[model samples]
Target: MSAITLEIDGNKVQVTDGMTVLEAADNAGIFIPTLCHHDKLEPFGGCRLCIVEVEERGWTKMVVSCVYLAAEGLVVRTRSDKVDRIRKTILELLLAHAPDAEVLKELAQEYGADKDRFEKDPSFCIHCGLCVRYCAEVKQKFAVGFVDRGIRKEISFIPEIAARECNACKECFPLCPTSYLQAAFVLTESLAFPAQQKKSE
Candidate 1:
């Protein structure tokens, strides 16, 4: 692949073709916050946390770096007042769901996100879909899925498929950004082996 040169945060970065702005920035050692992005998975842009300002066609516009392709002669600003405001807002929303996530907490602190900006929500999963994507794309299990829409959307395990497959393969455990999946796994195991639970106690 031919290398494409782009300017990120005032630094010239040369990256292979088909690389996203986020990947280019990462190659150049520029920090762009993201939640719904994992190197192992395709960019979903669910969290909208990696928004950056880019000069395109003489117009500066905010775009999510994780999905925006890097191009030659492109000027990107990873951090700016507008970008910071957008990222902080996204962080605040994520904290409402994954307050205990150390990754989220640290990123929130770095971006000066207000932990209390939004009302506390009981849900812990940020719904970044990492686990869902990992299960379907990488694991090929399709045991879980997102149900509902918008705020009502959530990860729901299909009991028949999940019970049959999830017990044997907890492959999506490490991909979750919150403890909700871990707790769910423990609950599933305890329910599956009540005898083991009693024996342990």
Candidate 2:
């Protein structure tokens, strides 16, 4: 593939074609924070933590670097006062769901985000879709999926498939930002997959 040159935080980088700005920045040794991006999965851009400023042809706009395609002559700024403010707001929103997540805590410190900025919700999931996508894309299990929508949306395991596939393939558990995947799995085992639970016991 041909090379694409771009400027990330004043550092010129040449990356392979089809690489996203996040990947390009990473290869160039520039730090860009992200919550919903993983190398093994397609770009989901759910967390909005890798937002960056891109300027080309005298126009500037903000985009999630994980999904934004890298291009020749593109100018990217991973962090600016405006970028930090946006990230701080996103972190504050996520922190409300997972106040104790160490990853969020560290980013919150860097961006000055208050964990209590939003009202507390019992669900600790930030809804990054890591587990859902990993199970479907990488594992091909389709065991876990999303339920509901908008304000009420959350992840859930489909007990029929999960009961048979999850325990043996718990690879996605560690990808959770708040460790909520394990809890969700345990709850599903108790509530949705009770037949299997009783048999196992």
TM-score of each: 0.89, 0.95
Expressed as tens digits, the lDDT of each residue in 1-201 for candidate 2 is 999899999989999999999999999999899989999999999999999999988899999999999999999999899999999999998988899998999999999999888998758889999999999999999999999998899998898899889877799989998999999999999997777767767
lDDT of 1 by residue, 115-175 (tens): 8889989588788888899888888888888889888888877665776677668888877
Deviation in angstroms for 152 in model 1? 0.9
Q: Residue 171 of candidate 1: its Cα lDDT?
A: 82
For each candidate, what is the lDDT?
0.84, 0.92
lDDT of prediction 2: 0.92
Misplaced by over 4 Å in model 1 are: 187-201
